[model samples]
Target: MEIIAPGDKFFHDIPEKIINDTRYMSYFKDCIGVIDGTHVDARIPVEEQAAYIGRYHSLTQNVIAACDFNMCFTFVSPGWEGSAHAVRIFKHAVMDPKYNFPAPPPVDAGYPLQRGYLRPYLGTRYHIPDFRRGHINAE
Candidate 1:
């Protein structure tokens, strides 16, 4: 996991292109990467059915991954129960000293914006579907 899961060094070391990109420069000035949760289909024993059924109503494992602008996975936390909320998984992860997730930056209005992982401002549209639908094609 260390080979791909970046250490603290990566937080301060982002590419020039990503830093200069107008799309990210302002809001994401200190952000080194992005984090997202995903559900991976899995087939588990009947006894574990209740534990693995995800929001989509299927057997799965919930995974949270952090990646750089280049789309390379820098950190991947898998094996959480499918029903687990992404926030819960993240909270548990950072609390574990062994995992050593990056420390968050200074508090922002009582809400500590995660240090290296830049969460979108509340109410901003950041859904994947929004990006999938091209602006040129949207009515």
Candidate 2:
């Protein structure tokens, strides 16, 4: 994992894609990567199947992963039961020292906010197409 995994140096600079794209260059200059979770089918013993069953009633494992803007994987944490919430897995990855998750840059580093991730507001129309069509109902 060490060979392919991103080191501290990888998080210090803006991605070339973001720098070149006018739409994201200014907004995402301080962003390092994106993180999310997905469920993958898993085979387990009958006794352990219950823990692995997800909303679809099938055995699966919830895998948390992070990737840079270039879509290259920087970190992956798999084997969590599918029943586990994504936030739970994400919290574990961030708090656990073994994961070696890269720390966010300092607030004084020109970021407007002191946050590691940015999430769109709930129930908001965030797509460019939606804005263009004038469907501006955000509530």
| Highest TM-score against the true fold, candidate | 2
Q: What is the C-alpha lDDT profile of model 1 across 50-107, one tens digit per residue? A: 9889987999899988776677777678888899888888877777978866554553
Give a tens-digit lDDT track for model 2, residues 8-108.
54467778999999999888888888777788999999988999999889999999888888788888889999899987887787779888766566534
Candidate 1 stretches greater than 4 Å from native: 1-3, 7-10, 104-118, 123-139
RMSD of 1: 4.5
The lDDT leader among the candidates is: 2
**Native-referenced Cα lDDT, model 2:** 0.76
- lDDT of each structure? 0.71, 0.76
